[model samples]
Target: MDLSDTQHRLLAYLREHIARHGYPPSQMEIARAFGFRQNRSARHHLEVLAQAGLIELATGRARGIRLTGPGTAGTPGDGLLQVPLLGRVAAGQPIGSDPEVRRELTLDPSLFRLRPDYLLEVEGDSMILDAILPGDLIGVHRTPQARHGQTVVARIEGELTVKRLDTGGAEGNGGHLRLLPRNPAYAPIEIDARIVDFAIEGLFAGLVRPG
Candidate 1:
C-alpha cells in the first residue's frame, strides 16, 4: 500500500526515534516539531495510517501507537486467556525448522493484558545490548507491528529472534527490515520475505527471572 507523503515522512521519523529511543514520539512532540496548526493534524495522519492497516493505537498514552508490520505470530495453549508460553526458538541459518520444543507454558492474561498465542525464550546476544540477557524469557503479544521500536520477537532469515523494529521510509519497499541491537558492539540485521519471513511473534511484554 502506498502511503501519503505526510504519512510516509511521519512514520519514518517515528521509526527513527524508536530505533534510537525505544518508544514512539509523543503527539505533543510531533505537533511542536511539525508545527501543525493543530495537534489534531498530526493525530489525523496517525489515524489514517492505522486505518490503512499499517499501525495501531494504545488508547490512553501520548505515543501509544503500534505498527502492525511483520513482528507478530502465535500457537495455541491452555489458560484463562489461553496464553501460550513457547519453549524456545531456533533462529539460526537453518530454514523451515521444526524445533524440538515440546512444552508451551500457561500464563495469566491479566499480567499482560494480552492473551498471547505463544511465548518463546530469548536465546541469543544480538539483542543483549537491549538489556535482554541470554536466558531471559520474552512474552510476545502476537501482533504484526511492534509499535515502531518496541522490542519484539521476530522471525528473520529463517531464524526467530528478539530485537527492536527500525523499518519505514521512501525506501520502504518489500522485505526490507532493519533489526537493531541496543549494544553498540553488535550491528543491526535486515532481511525481507524473500530471504527471511518477517513474522512478529509478539511483544516481549515481560520476563521471568528464577532467583
Candidate 2:
C-alpha cells in the first residue's frame, strides 16, 4: 500500500522494533524516536497508518501496533520472516561455538527463495571472492546435508566454519568431507569425519550486507 515517508519510516521502525525486542513500541517510544514533543504526535501517525491499512492497533493495549498487509504476520502472507542473527562463523579457521542471538532480522521471504532458519555473521575473508565477506550476515537454512558446490555451514570437531562444499573427489585427509574456500589465498580444509565431530549445520541462503 502507498504510504507517506513518515508512515513508511514508522512501519519500518515498528517491524525492526518487533523483530529485535519481540514487541511493538509504545507511543512514547515512537514519539521519542521521531522527535515529537508529545506522545499524541506518534498516535496521530499511527492512526493514519491504521487508516491506510498498514497496521492494526489494539484499543486498550500499551504496545498494540501490528503490521498488516504484505510484510507482516497473519495469514499465509509473503511477509517478513524473523531470522536469528547468530555470532561470528569463521571463514579462515574453526571457531568455538557461541551461537548467541545478536538480534532478529526481518527480511522478505522471497529474498532468499528459501526459508532461512538463521543468520550467521561472517568473521573472515575466506569466501570474499564469492561476495561473502567479513561482517556480512548470511541467511542459512538448517540442514544436515548439502550437495556438491553448494556453500554450507559446517561444524568440524565442534567448531563452526563456512565454506563451499566439495564432495565429488576421493576422500582427502582420510575422510570424505571438505570445506573449500572461494578465495585463492586460502587453502581448503579436508575433514576426517571419522576422527572429528562433523556435521552440516545449514545451507547458505542469502546475505545481508552492511550499508
Candidate 3:
C-alpha cells in the first residue's frame, strides 16, 4: 500500500523512536505521541506501516516492532564498531564447551558491539554469491531485532543460518521470517517459532576478506 502523508509522519516518528531507544514505539506510545484517542486508531496506522514494509515483529511480544531498511553501513562514515571473532562456532559440527577469540574485526559500531560474550562466523554456500563464503568472517549485532533486507545470523532449530532477513511484522506471527540466500541454488530458510532460539547476531553490516 502506498504510504499516505499521515503514514509518512507516523513512520518518521517511529524511526526517531528506534534511533533514540534502538526499538520501535508501542501502540499506546505511538497513540500518545500522535495524540490518537483510541488504541485501535493507533493500531490502524501501525498496521498500515507494516503493510507498507516498514517494520516487523522482531520479538514475539507485542510492540516488537523493528525498522526494516538499510542500516548505516558503509555510508562513508568513520564510526566503526569493532568486535572479536573469538573463534569459530561450528555450524556443521558440534560446539565444544567454549571457543577462543582468534581475531578482531572492525565494523559499524552503530550496528553492534563484539564483547567477550557473543561471536559469529559465515557458514554454507547460501550467501556465497554475496561473498559470504564458508569460513568467512561476519560481524554480528547480538540483537534479536533484525529488520528486513538486513543480513542476519539466525539460529533455526539449533542450527545457524546467515541470510538476508525478510520479516512479516505481527501478521507473520504464525511464523514468517525467511532466510534468503544470495545463491539461488539454495532455497530460502523459513523460520518457525517452534524449533530453535531465533536470534539476530546482528545486521550483516560489513565483511572482511583476507588477501
Best by TM-score: 2
Put down candidate 3 lDDT per residue, 1-211, tens digits, no spaces: 7888878898788766655433345788888878889878977877787777776543344455655544433224443333566554332322332346654443334543332134555555667676777666556556667666887666554556667877756233346667787887777766765454566645565544432
| Candidate 3: C-alpha lDDT | 0.58
Worst window of 10 by summed lDDT in candidate 2:
73-82
- Candidate 1 lDDT at 11 equals 77
- Global lDDT of model 1: 0.59
| Cα lDDT, model 2, residue 109 | 63
Error of 3 at 202 (Å): 1.9
- TM for every model, in the order presented, reads 0.48, 0.72, 0.47
Model 1, C-alpha of 93: deviation from truth (Å)? 8.5
**Candidate 1 per-residue C-alpha lDDT over 1-211 given as tens digits, one digit per residue, 9 for 90 to 100:** 6788888888777655644433457788888777888889989988888887766766676667655544211122322232344566433221242345444333334345454566565565666555566665555677766666777777764567667777644133355767677667666776674455567656777654322
**Best-to-worst ranking by lDDT:** 2, 1, 3
Q: Distance (Å) between predicted and true CA of 27, model 1?
A: 52
Candidate 2 per-residue lDDT over residues 9-80, each given as its tens digit:
998998777655444678999999999999998998999999988888778767667777556742365555
TM-score of structure candidate 1 = 0.48
Find the candidate with the highest lDDT and give its number: 2
C-alpha positional error of residue 7 in candidate 2 after TM-score superposition, expressed in Å: 3.4
Clashes of each: 16, 0, 8
